[model samples]
Target: MSTFHPFPRLPIELRLRIWSLTAFPRMIHVKRQCVGDHGEFGLQYMATSTPCPPVVQVCQESRRYAPYRRAFTTGAEPRYIWVNFESDMICNDGSHDLLNLEPHQQDIQRLRLPIDDELAYDYITIHGDQEFKKFTNIKEIHIAVDLQFAGFSIEFLAATVNKCFNGFDNKVKFLDVGSGYMMDANQLRILSDWKNYYSFDTHGRANVDTFEGAIRFMRILDNILTLSEMHAIDDENAKIKQDQQFL
Candidate 1:
């Protein structure tokens, strides 16, 4: 056969395995330049022999028509979706390559996001503002936010999260959010409503009483904090210890 095959004799099941890997990571950090008009860097970076463009072309043919065609003749021609870098703070590429398999909406279960405030804010600005109720299969969301830069009002944030997570798919097991004082009252109020969500606190800060009451928040006791900041809070903690001695 003179015609070149994108994947030679590889089992379709194996191909699916590879496809599943591309969908593997729920949290991705792509630099600003990571995405281009040609293709998202993630997809472009997939193991390829020739230049990037040909790789895509070959992959397109290899993937798109194969999976869905075998599944059912009625499906549409496969579209290659990518979670490319749309901006500085977000990884725009997620399941783009898997779409090449011509499957309907994909389902990814775990999301552990390790990002900065800029990206976190950017993510909230893009995806958080709305309810992601459709991603029903999503079971966990871990966000490491830089409270210094992430500008969120408490009530707004709490309400937003409640609206998104309070759905029927309460399978969400853990929510790790490390944010700061930059959050306004509106944001705090919103998060406080999620009193029942599990693993509410991995850090000691959740015990601090805010205007929102004893918040089942996610924070730590500054184990990761810099020495200077720890010293600042240490004085306050010392005063509390002294008061307890009198009692």
Candidate 2:
């Protein structure tokens, strides 16, 4: 009901600072959708549940200061969503092609992907690890998992991590949509150091539909993966020692 008409009279530096503050991080959901029909039916990059950056539509001054750029192009469509690679995260549902983002791979700093076996196989076995590695600036890799799924075995999860993210130095985290906690890979390793870490009788089964329960489910998976890696290393060392005995 009330408006500040004199706001424009404020200092230019102060006005710019206000606009800069509006540029916050966002979770952009990207998925492939069927566009066109009849003569031309194809999948294109679609930003679901995301709106264009407000600064881009506020005014000419704000638009000029906006950090977003149109990215994720294809042969049919050259432009898609406006993304701030520095602060905004691109969340993919594993249906879109990673190669479509090759042009801006170096600019993306944060990415979220689903922890699905088929998706992992596509990236590692079909597409090859080099394609995923093109996003050279990634600082964090968030793996979305569903705690309710019974098929998420430790061996499968470890294989996915090893095959897809073996040499990645970036932070790997696990997130469940139903949970409030986001567990870091490093913290999982540390927590697994305790005795009887595999015992989760207090937390119940992984299918418990609760926030705290979801976190406990994810922790169990992380602990198993950590132990599996340690065992693999021990086996490798034993083989090397046995070979040296013969020499």
Candidate 3:
């Protein structure tokens, strides 16, 4: 009898899933290699005013993930689509451009839009914004970056929360304030003001004021406990199912 070695092969979907699992793993590591590596332009694409597509391209290229880069690097629509949603992030250009598209083989998982103009966002929400509901399968989202002068604005944050959660009244599970340049009471309120909101990641200068000493340290423990609870329950269920198979 000849011993056989199983060849390592992953289905396209599985391979894509694995890639996404670590897609932005080093989210905290700011890659400063882009040309305008100075001031606000350093961390973002100045012209595009959007971070996801370009950031993904740069990182993918940095890792020599060329082919994958091209997969999303092209096409006018969904230039860089999140696999989970299979929905291309759309900029709020007066119309719900992304929502018009029909779902393909991949399931629509999430949706994102910019918090460009604060006033408009407020108007939409205050008037019982039915517009946001167009995002059919939205789940996870990245909204108004809080970083000013270079950071996300307060109005933008409020509107983003309202738009993404369908209302500011709802609770959001995961949120990233991300290197936002905090100044003034209004700016701070956006992060601290929310109710039932968890996870305050103060990665930028403003965070210095918010997360001092034990605050960050204790938060780390809380995160670990949450992770343990989630996984322990899943592991127990798997074990029970395995025993039932033998019985």
Candidate 4:
């Protein structure tokens, strides 16, 4: 492709807008690595899959437009990860300590974590509910289910959700990593109630044990949350219109 010689002559506002448009959401995987003997001083590092945003290195103007910031540092050295907290989703494999991210808790909006025995014990049973409150601005929590532990009871899952992410109006999604199927948390609650009321075996009836079954189950919960959100907006608009008519 030929370079446009007149590109630099464009208005500063237009140039900035173009740079802003280049910003896209990213999924950054973070895990703690044992850098010392006996895993004494573990350090969290970004996986090779996540690369630095190109806009940051393009030009000074583009760097200014990019929202990426250096975060999740160990403080022992200059090592850190470039994070676009507003749009990037941090995928933690239940290795890094959540306390390490407390500095930027309010800025991180999206997070994906594995839900298993380790997570349930650490975050729910051991730390209790207070540890999760650090993320004040969290909007979405993606809980990846570990299919290896097929005996996960609905009570345990619901308790984990309520204890770890309670009091927040964030969207919760459960992802079966083996099948890459995602389900809404509200739908899971409904399923739990239906199972209890009808005396159905939780594992046998849920049908999320197999890949094909998980995909079919996820389809039912896919747009349920989105449709509810649309109805909420319509109700708010109607209320506003009714009040305006009397003015």
Q: Which candidate is the best by TM-score?
A: 4
Name the regions of candidate 3 deviating beyond 4 angstroms.
1-108, 116-129, 149-177, 180-247
List ranges where model 4 is wrong by over 4 Å: 37-39, 42-48, 96-99, 116-125, 199-247
Q: Report lDDT (Cα) of residue 3, candidate 3.
A: 32
In model 2, the runs with Cα more than 4 Å from the true position are: 34-46, 73-75, 96-100, 116-128, 178-181, 187-247
- Give lDDT for model 1: 0.37
lDDT scores of the candidates, listed in order: 0.37, 0.62, 0.36, 0.64
> CA shift at 126, candidate 1, in angstroms?
4.4
Candidate 4 clashes between residue pairs 3 or more apart in a chain or in different chains: none
Encode model 4's per-residue lDDT on 1-247: one tens digit a residue: 5866786899988887887677678988765554574347754443325888988887777777766777777544436777888889987654435334536667789987766555444554456467667877888878777656655655566666666666652377777776676656665665455445543465546434443353455456562345467558779999999999999
User: TM-scores for all candidates?
Assistant: 0.33, 0.65, 0.32, 0.73
Candidates sorted on lDDT, descending: 4, 2, 1, 3
Report backbone clashes per prediction. 21, 0, 10, 0
Query: RMSD, each candidate, Å?
Result: 15.3, 8.3, 13.5, 5.1
The prediction achieving the highest lDDT against the true structure is 4
Question: What is the overall TM-score of model 2 with all chains considered together?
Answer: 0.65
Q: Rank the candidates by TM-score, best first.
A: 4, 2, 1, 3
- Estimate, for each residue in 14-103, the C-alpha lDDT of model 3 and write its tens digit: 545544544432111111122332333322211233344333444443234322232222222333333213334333322212222233
The number of clashing residue pairs in model 4 is 0
Worst 10 residues of 2 by lDDT: 187-196
